[model samples]
Target: MRDIPVLFNNKDECCGCAACYSICPQRAITMSEDEMGFEYPIIDKTKCVCCSICIKTCPVKINAL
Candidate 1:
């Protein structure tokens, strides 16, 4: 397994868009609800192929340096 690149380092940076989850070819991304009931992405690194598709799909991640 490889070290998966974390898409969102800050929770606030996420816009709750399911693009990453929807676009994951490896079925590695899951939408998980936070305490506030807002759904965020949870990555299954074990299943992730490190394709970076998730990162590309994330709107917030696009702005990440």
Candidate 2:
């Protein structure tokens, strides 16, 4: 198993997009709501293969380039 990079350091860094969850090949990502009713991706490391596809699918990451 490899160390997976965190999805987002802060909530502000994420845009509540489900792209990461939709792209996970291992089905390791799930969306959970925050107290403010915002959805964020949660990674299940037990299922995650560390493929980093979720990171690659992030709109925020794409727009950063």
Tens digit of lDDT per residue, candidate 1, span 1-65?
Answer: 55686878788889998999999999898899988999989999779888888887788867865
lDDT of 2: 0.90
Model 2 sits at a Cα RMSD from the real structure of 1.1
How would you encode candidate 2's per-residue C-alpha lDDT over 3-23 as one tens digit per residue? 886999999889998999998
TM-score of every candidate: 0.86, 0.91
Q: RMSD of each candidate?
A: 1.7, 1.1
Worst-scoring 10-residue span by lDDT in model 1: 1-10
Highest lDDT against the true fold, candidate:
2
Please report how far candidate 2 places residue 46 from its true position, in Å. Answer: 0.4
